[model samples]
Target: MKTHRLVQNFSGYRALICALPERSTEALAPTLKKLGLQSELIGHSPAAPVVLPFENINADRDILFIDGDMTLPMDWRCLRGAGRSALPPAPVVGLVGIEAPSRLKALLLLGATAFLAKPVYGGAVYSALFLGVNEYNRKEILVDAVDVLYEKRRRRAVVIKAVVSLMNIRNIDEDVAYDLLRKESMRARLSIEDYCEYMLGLRQEQDKNENAHGERQALKG
Candidate 1:
């Protein structure tokens, strides 16, 4: 149920160019500069394999410009088939030269949200940057939501356990126990699962204290 505003300003973002030194790339740098983005040409050559700076990539601060002309080191087809990470660490804009399906597919696998045609038109740069960055943000938000759903599903057992414990302790029916738990969770300003976990923890501590007190009394007797 969360919403995000699209990022309009791209100032302080770094553009990481992962392409061979060419006229297109040369033209791209100044365009990025005009948009207030600092450009860094990564060392990529046709003779040598392309090495993506994966570790240094930051989703918040960096935007990638990958050459669609070059053959990337990793097998995109196999990676996608194997269910490896489809999304790159940063937002990517494909520097597309060849209009072939194979080349475009490679960019898609690399998670390119936008494309700039070869020979780099300065006018299209801003549009490409805006689309790429915002699209990446949107995907990230979706991924986070999926993770939260998975976590909540995993904690369902804990919630059930807490409900059972409450029913036994209070001599109440399942529905009443569940309703009580829901109300308490709202009062505590926590999700039902989280509040149930907290209540269980408190019960555990109380049991430990009671056991210790019983032991002390038996020692005196």
Candidate 2:
């Protein structure tokens, strides 16, 4: 079954060109408008692109046109880059210069899904936007899958500890303990891993109280 919905036409889509508000943006704007996308220019300082607030940007519809002339905002550590296992908050198109290794690397780190040459042209806008948006969507799917697998692997040992603790405390067999935990997890509206962690904490507190009570009785005797 085909589940994915493709973004066919750009109607009411918003784009931000992250660079100096110069002639390039002036040329780019009218082309974007014709395509039914609202475009704006975003200028970054000589220092970094951190001043370009990512929080204001939308993940699905926003597109970034990052100029390769200056350094990217490393301060935006949460920003996804080219080689990362995750996608950036939005798709990015790089505006290139002489194409030096360092300059290209900066664009890669900003997670530029597509590239557009300097002296932006009207003909190239639709193609760049098409590639950038689609490529980013593909990467996001793969990244999300990897994250789910990693979390499951990390919690495997915790699952064992939780199961063993349940068996000992409840004086039940391993299978029974696991089933009980599973049922309780459903009741609590939690994942099995989360419920197990919660149970473990309760077990620790119960042990402390029992030990304290035993000591009090012994002292009195």
Candidate 3:
């Protein structure tokens, strides 16, 4: 999936190229023109509209932003570059000054695709665009990543709630409730929601198919 294809199909300005005081757009103008990029240059503040120009531009076109003020990691910016270069949901690049490994890692984890030192180069900008990665896959990948994170958090809460529920039901100590939850989890071989629902008899209809599988095995034996 070429990044340009996605951008073209979607509509609007595909790229927003901004630079720091030192970086020169002159270095990359030739390359950008050669590539037939539909891009806008933002020099000083207000040279471009700060607010999203949704009505003016194509609704579906992904925005590729190159802002220097915001600190970010190289990989994070690279990810953005890859996305913008290949598919829709354009990548935004931010510059960072901090050199600490932890800080850099945090920025990368936070989703910076690529980064550059103070003096930005045309080659770096060109590389971010030409290296190209599929942006359409981004939403799907991000959604799944978020889901996994959300589920982990939800599971922790479910454990806490199950323990509390057991304590309430049995008039037992918290430890006892935890023990009950543990046992039930082992027995059901299901996740927290399933475990909780089973305990409360909330998903009996949904479990019928699963129960029938055991019955079939018993008959075969």
Per residue, candidate 1 scores C-alpha lDDT tens digits across 10-64 of 8999998888788866778998898899988765555675556667778889998
The candidate, 1 or 2, that scores higher on lDDT is 1
| C-alpha lDDT of candidate 2 relative to the true structure | 0.78
Better of 2 and 3 by TM-score: 2
| Over 4 Å off, model 1 | 1-3, 72-86, 207-221
Q: Write the per-residue lDDT of candidate 2 for residues 1-221, one digit (tens) a residue.
A: 11244566777888877776656556787988999988876654555443556778886778887788745454545666444576677888888755899888878877888898767888988888888888877777777778788898899787789989878877898899889989999999999999988988988899999999999999999
Error of 2 at 45 (Å): 9.9
Candidate 2, residue 75: Cα displacement in angstroms equals 6.4
Q: Compute the lDDT for candidate 3.
A: 0.51
Q: In terms of TM-score, how similar is model 3 to the real structure?
A: 0.40
Which 10-residue window of candidate 1 scores lowest in summed lDDT?
Answer: 76-85
- Ranking the candidates on TM-score from highest down gives 1, 2, 3
Q: Model 2 has how many clashing residue pairs?
A: 0
* Separate clash counts for every candidate: 0, 0, 14
All candidates' lDDT scores?
0.83, 0.78, 0.51
Better of 1 and 3 by TM-score: 1
Candidate 3 stretches with Cα past 4 Å from truth are 1-13, 19-23, 43-49, 52-63, 67-90, 94-111, 116-124, 130-147, 159-221
lDDT of 3 by residue, 1-221 (tens): 21233322322226555543344444444445555556665444544333333344432444444544433223232232233223223444444455667656654543445554434465565555432223333544565566677777876766677677678767999887877777777888876566875665643554687899989999999
